[model samples]
Target: MSAAGPILEVEAIQAFYGTIQALKGVTLQVNQGEIVTLIGANGAGKSTTLRTINGLMHPKAGKIRFEGQDITTTPPHQIVAMGISQSPEGRKLFPRMSVTENLEMGAFQRKDKENFKDDTERVFEYFPRLYERRTQKAGTMSGGEQQMCAIGRALMARPKLLMLDEPSMGLAPVFIEKIFEIVVQINKDGTPVLLVEQNALMALDVANRGYVLETGRVALEGPAAELKVNDRVRKTYLGEG
Candidate 1:
């Protein structure tokens, strides 16, 4: 790990959407080279926490840091420039844009061509399907293919940390498995990930550590293996009694 500390740190954050409170003092961390997952039921504030961290929604309270630098009040665009890139819940790609164009947009804040080329190559390496469809409009692709393009676009940012929200949503079982496998490979290749997913089984499988959220609070947290076997977690999130 860098002497700078965790790749991301969230301390007791509270968030609100209009009058509705979303995140209630949630705290978490993603250390260098680790995949940390946030798993919870619907309305448990999983996505809210990610939104708060990414600056799409600012926390009403608490602090956020990236690489030990305070970013609690950073603007969303600046936050992206600061090396935190997020592939949001909906694969919000530019529908009219080709796969390569979408990936290029990911590097909009970047000015270096050589590194951009390298990053695009790395993304294609991870998702060869993107390479095959490089010229196809993103909106015309299958859900799985679009998901890969979304992630590939995020990778083009060459983020110091990647935050993926619900990557497996709407995907077929086969695609889900493939996406999770690639997630592990990406983590292994050196980008720390903070994943917010409802697929607790798959999320925990790839995660190094996890936090379970309930009603906007952290209900449980531990190493992934421990959380996997926890009675409550198994019953609530893992579909077992």
Candidate 2:
């Protein structure tokens, strides 16, 4: 890993929807080769922060830097091509498209096709179910399978940084465990990940560091192990109270 600074940085970002401010000067970073997680309750601005960084929602204030370049105002597609790809919260796959076709759309913006076949094979390796259902329509797959395809599609972009939002949502417990394992393996393969998850226990278990958000502000931030043991976090998020 490069000893350089963080690959993705959000410096006091403030985002708004209409007149409602969702992010209150939120600042975070994902360094190379690390899995950093953002854990929070509903309406804590986790997804909004991602939307802002991915250029789906430009912040009214603050700067976003990816690999040391300013991308606060960059377009979403440009941001993806610049190596920041997201598998959003809802598993937003092309329902009518086959698993292979949906994966193809993920690489639609890539200028390099030399590794297309190799990358597809890698995705299949990660989600063997996708391989079995490669020709099936994404919408017709089970929730877990669709989630796998959504993540697989994001991987097809060959992102330098992968951002996943609520990846474990609406899935069976078995699939959740499997998903987190794959997430760790993905990080091991050299792509830094920014995870926004509702499962605080699972998120902190696999994360190197974590941030806790409340009402759009960072309530606490620390090493994942530390956060996992924090009194407040235990009571509220971990169900340890």
Candidate 3:
């Protein structure tokens, strides 16, 4: 792929949960090394959008292309192998597993031993808290620590496109700031990010570009700074004037 080509592309995608539509003709793109955000109210299908792209949820219609190949119907495992990884909403870490074990689980699809070791160190570098508590059970960790573990697990996959679904969901104000800062650092280090967040203001502030999801469709999109100043977005999503 060219340096300017989109790293991930979704075109006219419609996703569903057993007949109830969650994504209605949603389309978006993320370019190489950029941070992109999807922001909206609850039940606006932001999580579903991320899940569909990672193949956790299949779209009922349309296409998803990664690195220029069509992966619309690819299985979730295959999608992960193809370099897309998601830290899902709610920080779904395994309760009984040690943090290191959880991170190991994330690289299950890989057979390369050296790559796994390198990625594990990289994840710990990104979240030192995880490294310090590597031997502790994930379920015993605080919400913020668990979120860090979830992100660390995803990072263990060494993805080209990293998708985060509400990383700030239950974090304190301070942890929220820290998480977003780490996101920027990760993107700057060459992994493109697609963030799905209800914290619209924070998301937009960090993203290079953004798309506003409303009831499963995109109602607005543009550069992150531009959307931050958009009046309708301010009033409805950003909790601004």
Flag regions of model 3 displaced more than 4 Å: 1-3
Instruction: Please give, for residues 1-241, the per-residue lDDT of candidate 3 as tens digits.
Output: 1237798999999998987999999999999978999999999999889888888788989999999999998999999999999998898899899999999999888878688888889988999999999999999999999999999899888899999999999789999998999999998899999999989999998999999999999999999999999999999987776
lDDT of 2 at 161: 95
Cα lDDT, all candidates: 0.91, 0.95, 0.91
Clashing pairs for model 2 are: none
TM-score of decoy 2: 0.98
The candidate, 1 or 2, that scores higher on TM-score is 2
Q: Which stretches of model 2 miss by more than 4 angstroms?
A: 1-4
Over the stretch 1-241, how does candidate 2's per-residue lDDT look in tens digits? Answer: 3424699999999999999999999999999999999999999999999999999999999999999999999999999999999999999999999999999999999888998999999999999999999999999999999999999999999999999999999999999999999999999999899999999999999999999999989999999999999999999999996
TM-score of each: 0.97, 0.98, 0.96
- Candidate 1 local distance difference test against the native: 0.91
**In model 3, which residue pairs have backbone atoms overlapping below 3 Å?**
none
Model 1 ranges off by over 4 Å: 1-4
Clashes per model (N, Cα, C within 3 A) = 0, 0, 0
- Residue range with the least summed lDDT across 10 consecutive positions in model 3: 1-10
